[model samples]
Target chain A: MLSIKNLHANIEGKEILKGINLEVNAGEVHAIMGPNGSGKSSLASVLAGRENYEVTEGEVWLDGKNLLDMKPEERAREGVFLAFQYPVEIPGVSNINFLRTALSEIRIHRNLPPLSAKEFLKMTKEKQELVEFEAKLANRSLNQGFSGGEKKRNEVFQLAMLDPKLSILDETDSGLDIDALRIVSNGINKLRSADNAFVLITHYQRLLEYIVPDFVHVLYNGQIVRSGTKELALELEEKGYDWLKEELQGQESINTK
Target chain B: MMEKDDMMLDELANKEYEFGFVTDIDMDISEVGLNEDTVRFISAKKNEPQWLLDWRMKGFKAFQKQEMPQWQNFKMPDIDFQSISYYAAPKKQAKYASLDEVDPELLRTFEKLGIPMSEQKQLAGVAVDVVFDSVSVSTTYKEHLNEMGIIFCSISEAVKNHPELVQKYLGTVVPHTDNTFASLNTAVFSDGSFVYIPKGVRCPMELSTYFRINAENTGQFERTLIIADEDSYVSYLEGCTAPMRDENQLHAAVVELIALKGAEIKYSTVQNWYPGDKDGKGGIFNFVTKRGACRGDHSKISWTQVETGSAITWKYPSLILQGDHSSGEFYSVAVTNNMQIADTGTKIHHIGANTKSRIISKGISAGRGQNSYRGLVQMGSKAKNARNFTQCDSLLIGDQCGAHTFPYIESKNNTATIEHEATTSKIGEDQVFYLNQRGIDAEQAIALIVNGYAKEVLNQLPMEFAVEAQKLLSLTLEGSVG
Candidate 1:
């Protein structure tokens, strides 16, 4: 459902994502694994159309439409969801009200009727149950004074609410405990459908254990150098990225000779 | 997104004031100038008794000696008192027994202001006293209130009909010699609402007054008095609007409230006097003095206001807690946009032991507007174990706008517990982007943020006033974001 070809991006004149090429069909799960500074999160940010990142060269297509031409809000309305690594704390804005506004905006963009107050509340309750979010947390300001686990759970709850076709979870499991990880993964698993896709950007193999990926790619130096099945994650966990770096150096020297 | 947001803000900046149209009606305007003769003319026009005329002469004498205040940060142009007309009222008879007797054009003016003076469209459960320029034209629900032994009528009507009540508590809370504006207001104050609730009785409905300024170059000086007798309760609200003009008009008003033992009084105000055009050419210079006195034990007084319009606003609504265990509260949300200036706050005086007071003030400044909060909390020596809590917050939308806070506190007894909290914040571009990313437009985002900032004060308003206040806030802060 999503395709990216040779995506070149930078921030402040420094290139971050040198060249990224990826394609994912419906019902497929792609896990992008890399170490710090390997551009995994940068790819997610570029795909989400963050203003700070300048797309130097490339094209990204979502449902046969050019994604780079849209604003961040337009991208959001067009079903591109990014679960921020650090959710913003919007003081004084109730969680429910913000979600309702967002839902209405999306509905208007899609030419659908706005949900009634009762229907909105019911949907919110259902989504809250699906993500196991606390009831009181939904009434307070958006993510204000929320615990780390609760913030992640709120992101998942929002994902359930929006029902986006492409959801890029950026390190959502970083600060989550084992129980939170299980709940988030179970929520995502329940949301996965044949018409949608998931791009899991994570640094550790721990998350893939609960929500298994169909394909695992090792992103090194802003490029995906190794691609394999789910077993590749176990191999990487057994042997860290140093061996991969050494193997890449050996291959570069051989090519030079 | 930033460009789109900027464009939207541009459109909002040029939005016209919808209530700026003037009603073409003949008026009974006073001769230009301020003097004893002018005050006497106003008194003669009202057919006042000798004591009331003498009181006006005293106010005029006091006003001549007092000087205009200069302590506020706002700069004021020298006002030519001689150039302003002291009184202007619609051409009508002295007394109207019913609505049909009132002038049709005057009724149309009220209708244009969205305040239907006609009986069929009058607001239910709320009695309104409509003040047109210098005189009260109509008062609704008078007989119903009278049946309950509650007196709600124009100040002139009260002086003629209920002389004893009017003489007993006219200026008890705010005397004519209190301030320059209060003195001037007393000297030629034409008409306003007067309410009196009997002992142990609760006012059945809300009491309201709508003040409108129609005549050019006329100064509106209206006085309001509300007294809740022992063990009584009442809720009073005031609103005002004016026509657009090229030269600034003056509106100096005085409001006094008194609550006796075991009584409670709640006062809410939504002041929407015409704020000048975008260039700040002409608007109302609203200088007001409003104060309440808690005279008996366990009495309470609360002031809630939403001020969003005016070229320059200078007002401080205060409360004197003279009774033991009496409580006073002030909740205000002041918004200034496009060169509007507002310097407003409240004063709380704890005179009796175990008294309590609370103040919550929110100020928003945008588009070169200047907003300030100046407050004072005083505890006398005999105010043993008194307590006070104050919270002041200011929000600025654009860099050109200004927000200020000045709080003065005096405590004579060590047992007084006073706490104060203040915060200042800006609506930054990143905050806007954060909301934009959630599919909310910039205008909606700004309005939401502002409403959230002023939620505490807005929550204190009555239901009808709350909705109107919300709308006024959005209108005032529109296009303020950069």
Candidate 2:
């Protein structure tokens, strides 16, 4: 469902994602693990079409469309969703209204009829239940005064509402408590389907316990150095990225020789 | 969505003033100058009685002693008062018996401005008084207003017919010597709406006045007076537009409202004077003095205004709570875009015991526009247990725009409770990106954010106007951001 070839991205002329390559098929969950500044979030931002991250060399294809050529909104309409790690607080815009506008825009792109207010409301209620988002939060300004947990849950609620084809969860468990982590993971688990895929980007192996991934890739020095099954996450949790750093150093020295 | 948003923004950025076309009707315009002769000419043209003419002379004298104000945040080129034509009225019969007798060109002007003036197409349950340049051209729903003993007519007509009512309330709330602009407006004011709701009577319909500036190089100085007698209620709305001109025109209007014991008065204004082109070469300098006096116990007055135009706007709609337990409220949304400048707010004087006031102001600045909120809240020594709550919020769309807030709160009584809160926010790239990531374009994103910012004040406008004000807000800020 998604492909990234030699993804080289930069910010302020400093390269971040250097020679990164990845791919994911339908119905598969892929976990990209990395330490601080490993370009995990940068990769997500590049895929989402953030203007600041200039893609020096890359090709990102979603389904059959060239994703790199699309605008941020176009990427969204093409079913590429990025759950921002730090959600923007947009006061005065109600969550319900924002969701409705997004849904309408997506529907227009698909050449489908717009949802009526009643149908939209019903859909919102159902999604709210799925994500366990508080009902009152829907009427307030979009994440204006929402707590950290509420914001994350709201992002999941949006994911459910949008139902994107390829969902990239960028550190969705970074600031979650035990209960919030459970709720967020439960919501993601429920959203898992046979036709869609998810890219779980995280630093800790804790989230892998809830939404187990079919493949785990360790990203170091802007490159995915290793790939294995779910057992790789358990091994990393027991050791840490320190072992991975040493392994990369050994491989670099051998290549130079 | 991206292309469509850009197109809409381009259209709004280059939107021409739809009401810029001038009617071909002959005008009775005064010579270019300001003096005793100019004031007398205006009064004489209106056929004012001796007392009113004397009032004009007093105002003229007072204006001579006052220098132009210099304390505002906006910059202004020195106004050439001597070169401005003080009065310009459409040459027609003093009183039109019906719509048929009015000039077709003048009627077409109204139609183009979307002002429903004909009785058949008039807004239901609303009385409209149309003021063209400096004269009241036609007043609709007069017979309906007369049946309820509600005297709604031109101020000049009020002076001739309801002289007692006019004399009692004229300049009562805003005196001729109030300020430089106030005195100037009083001295050469031509004509505006006059509304009087009798005691114990609620007005049968909303009272509205549409003021249009047509003649070039002429200053529109209109005087409006509305009196809500004891135990009465009335909602008055005023709208303004002007023809496009290269040289900046002056509009110094004075509106005085009086609410007697147990009465309530609601005054709303949607000021859309031309804001000049993108370079801000020509437009209107709107210097208005509007004040409401709650003269009897328990009287209430509210001022709601949406200011989106005018190259230079210096206005303060004030409320004087002179009666015990009186209340005053001011809700305003001011948008300045593309080199426009606006310094507007409200003044609340709590002079009576237990009086209260609430002020909500939203200032949105875009492009190189500058917006400022200068408000004054005073609690007198005798105003025991008075309360005032003020909230001022500003939204800056781009780095070039500016927003300023100057709040003056003076409480002589220790028992008064005054609270003021202010916030300044920018339309950050992240906010726009977030909306875009949700499939909403930048234009709609900014519009949504701005509308949310101004929702509190927009909610205060009357129903029909709220919709128009919302659209105007979007129109004013379109293409303001890159």
Best-performing candidate as measured by TM-score: 2
Clashes of each: 0, 0
State candidate 2's TM-score. 0.93
lDDT (10s digit) by residue, model 1, range A1-257: 79999999998889998888999888999999988899998898888877778999989999999999987788888888888888877778788988998889989999999999999999999888888888899999988899898888888888898888899999999999999999999999999999889999998899999999999999998888898878999889989888999999899999999
DockQ of each: 0.46, 0.48
Which 10-residue span in candidate 2 chain B carries the lowest summed lDDT? B1-10
Expressed as tens digits, the lDDT of each residue in B34-107 for candidate 1 is 99899989999888999898888888899999999989878876899899999887776546888888777777
Mark the 10 consecutive residues where model 1 chain B has the least summed lDDT: B1-10
- The per-model lDDT (C-alpha) reads 0.88, 0.89
Candidate 2 all-Cα RMSD: 3.2
Error of 1 at A221 (Å): 5.1
Of all native A–B interface contacts, model 1 reproduces a fraction of: 0.46
Reference-based lDDT, residue B122, model 1 = 42
lDDT of 1: 0.88
Clashing pairs in model 2? Answer: none
